[model samples]
Target: MLLELFTGKCPIDECFSGDVNLPKWVQSAFPENFMQVIDSKLLVGDVCNEDHDDGDGDDDDNLYVSPEIQVEYCLATVIEIGLSCTRDSPDGRITIRHALQKLKNAKHNFLKNRNGEKM
Candidate 1:
């Protein structure tokens, strides 16, 4: 729940719904402007509402992304996220830190569970 409220990644249904264990200082690192490109509507304005049967099939050209080109998209997004959050605003910095700590806690819990270690 906290992660969803903070990360703003994925759909609301896909968001993590659990209490975040990040400290106040760490939670303050992530920026409040965090955004995720879930739908292409933001990229191509009103494109979804356009007529597709106009025979241009060139509408396919507007849809540049191919499911088969997964590797390129995967790496690009990974790099993009890694380099994102420049902390241009104070909220940005806090959001980054909070999201980072939240992710760290999730990783820690996963490792402990896998190793049968107590946390």
Candidate 2:
């Protein structure tokens, strides 16, 4: 469930760890910290059943995050990451599609590792 928009991989182990000790560019560019801020407001019972370990709630578990929130978070992260890259690169720009593809690759690798599937 970790969502990020970095051109490179995340350095921390946890999705919401929000370790700010990394480079400033990463801190500003990734959505990890931003997501942490949003998640911190969740009361004990506010989050979806699946997000919690208890998982006994009757509500459907299909949608842990609403589509609107997902879109906003994703876009913010992409913009920040793109800005950082453009700042460093001579081209001074990035495409939304490419940024999203990087996120997809990171998620695929993470899921494969978690599932204990060998490469």
Candidate 3:
């Protein structure tokens, strides 16, 4: 479910017709580098542009919340949660409560880095 949500690819997607299902595909896509697997539509443009004036009307190049970095961090965390949920063995998988807490933490951290940027 989480894989489908973030990847925009259904569990029964044509790519998952063989031994590689959605979970496996997603797992292989991430772990090392998840950028290749993330749906482009989910991440586009900057969270907030640097066009705003800070009293002096000069360009403020100090904003550290880069769109790429912010989105990358959030997506990585999300994919990690999804991968944990999709573990082969239920005993090794994360609990629903644990997953939810991790998700909340991811969101909190993601937002905190956004610097009040709108989605």
Predicted structure with the largest TM-score when compared to the true one? 3
- All candidates' TM-scores? 0.23, 0.30, 0.79
Q: Candidate 2, after superposition: displacement of residue 34 in Å?
A: 16
* Candidate 2 global CA lDDT score: 0.43
TM-score of candidate 2 versus the correct structure, residues matched by position = 0.30
Go through the candidates in order and give the C-alpha RMSD of each one to the true structure: 17.5, 12.7, 4.0
Tens digit of per-residue lDDT, candidate 2, span 1-119 = 12223223353534335544233434464565544333322323422322422265655444345433443455455445544444445566456566668767655654553343333
lDDT tens digits by residue: candidate 1, 32-61: 312332222323332133222325555444
Which stretches of candidate 2 lie above 4 Å from their native place? 1-90
Estimate candidate 2's RMSD in Å.
12.7
Number of backbone clashes in candidate 2: 0
Best by lDDT: 3
For model 2 the local lDDT of residue 72 reads 47
Report the alpha-carbon TM-score of model 3 versus the true structure: 0.79
